[model samples]
Target: MKPITALFAATLLASATAAVADDNLEKLGQFKTTGASPEIPTIPQTGPKADAIKKTLAKIKLPSGFKISLYALVPDARHMAVGPQGVVTFVGTRKNKVYAVTDRAKSGVADDVKPFASTIDLSIPNGPCFSKDGFLYIVEQNRVLVYPAAEFFYESPDVVAVPIVPKGELIPKDEESYNHTARVCRVGPDDKLYITLGQPFNVPAPEKLELYKKWGIGGIIRMDRDGKNREVFVNGIRNSVGMDFNPKDKSLWFTDNQVDGMGDKIPPGELNRATEAGQNFGFPWYGGGKVRTNEYKSETPPANVVFPQVEMDAHAADLGMVFYTGKKFPKKYQGAIFSAQHGSWNRTDPVGARVMVTYLKEDGTADKTETFAEGWLTSDGEYLGRPVDVAMLRDGSLLVSDDFAGALYRISYEGH
Candidate 1:
């Protein structure tokens, strides 16, 4: 062979090999770097302790005509997604398991709680969302998977999950971290899948800001369910574990956990509204709303940075949220937003550990914020149950998942 032709052939071979290696890494995920695949531990199926649940229920405080009851005993429940049929409620966890809380009796309460996708291995499988057409989407630490006919097929032992975003492609391998690893997903009315990517750092270094922006980390990204045409929907958010679309205006709303270590009450948690794409909610620059952090004090934030609609109490780790669209609740709560304050861990006096309601004005702007439910945090700074997510059942009742108590509670209302 001629010398030039031989050289060209060698270069082509090397290029092909590199492409193949990249493909393998994408398919294998973090196991490529760690050399060991993490296994999902076998979780025992057990109901919540009846006496303990009764004690917790007695401690719960709700508005007049409202009552809270044990719905299921799902361990490590973080985020929840109710199926279209309302027969199955999917619960996600920060751990390796996802649970299906089934209401077999068609009653408001769930009768059975079982592990979902038990055959497939997962990492930080904390976000479970459903499309209007009944597709169940699960977002893990590094990938997205969808289960078709999920409500029906969940009963089977081996349900196949179709990969929408292949493993290791959601975020760069170097950016992954154990902290803020939990992701939340929602299907918008525009027929797109939205996923939140919380940057690993509490206050990211200035040097890493551009890369985080380019990769859509520390913000919400939206794409087709097939994982194409992805774009950052909101930016400059610091670890938002929950989000939901307003049924009225179809705008995206989310709960963001602000910066810590700047004293307990300096920067508050945020409930923000994103009216359009490409909106930047001030993050490292302004930790919550207007409170600037020391790390980014030297840098100037974007001129048009958006602020939160409601600034919640500091250290109140806000998580999953949903707009109240059910009819069972009174007319007052028709368009209100219900979000879970997972409670704070960094304060001398613990706060939150309750469900909060944010009322909206006629113009679709936030009007006022109030505590919808409390009693999770004891007087002595101990938490009986930490609410992680708030989901609505078909009967207009709300289901609150508690990771601390390893159970789900249903809050319903009867006329006074």
Candidate 2:
């Protein structure tokens, strides 16, 4: 498990970019890609930057008996996937790097943070998810790559990388977007890989809606582990950066960022539930809740367009979420949904640089939503740190990523 040489890194990148579809993962899994040479760079665990990030956390507010601490210094940390063994956490970014943050000593705070597979050319590698069986899947702008046994072997530079969806195949290259291109994924209860594809435009032209629907853009799609049997799971979503499966019914729940430019107060954000495949969640026809987007207001929305289960305040820019399945939290917090509000960028008065918790009723539907953590926004409308995603560690402690801060914060509960 030695580090790869600079020559090997460059060669591997070329091969991966040129003929990624021809990769023989089964053969590569046999340690055929091993090499020895330069080690990847690791972010400093303690430095001025880390200390600066900690000072900002002092302003963060959580419920009683809870504490927040700096977990890792991950650059552009967007969504996160905790390893099955709790040995490592693969964090995705809106840029080209996928970081591996490790708490190898089980010290509660991460001691090591470094780029995973630093040689590979990653494009907006914003979604990293793990299956229970030890595979790490990273969904990029137009490709999906999986690393076998990623949790245990990510330290090695030559760890096997396999493509689930080859380059430029996740979506049409012509429709690729810089905005709304940050994807998120999860391994579902049924062992399928679910990914969200955000449609590029603020609101697409009416003529392109049908094409977007057909291509699964601005929606969620599912496929087998090997990237076979791919199909659109849900449609009519504008831009969903986060999703997760409910432990209760195994149904899919997600947060969608509604269309902009429809005024600051109209058309609230959405949290939706998809009980079955091929369901539409109401996009262009109804922007958010029953508020219709002006672009397609005159047109008739598809029949049976399912609306949001909970309509949040407009322009909160809701992103990643996870279900609470850990035991360390109190019973009241168990089974609740924890989500991140990335906050609004263009609103005259900013809102939602916080973490949210949604409680569910006995019937498994959302009962109510409330703020769980706040103070990322200052009184003067300046953002101290914009929360991006929330993930659960094996110990039931919560890890929240902030791209604005380039760091991760850990929240643990200790009863009085």
TM-score of each: 0.89, 0.93
> What tens digits encode model 2's per-residue C-alpha lDDT throughout 33-126?
5343448789988889988888888888889999999998889999999999889999999898999999988888998999887656688999
Error of 1 at 104 (Å): 1.5
Tens digit of lDDT per residue, candidate 1, span 42-89?
Answer: 334343475687688898899899989888778888899999998799
lDDT of 1: 0.88
- The superposed Cα distance between candidate 1 and the true structure at residue 161, in angstroms, equals 1.0
RMSD of each: 8.7, 5.2
lDDT of 2: 0.89
Candidate with maximal lDDT = 2
Clashing pairs in 2: none
Instruction: Give me the runs in candidate 2 sitting further than 4 Å from their true place.
Output: 1-31, 34-38
Runs off by more than 4 Å, candidate 1:
1-48
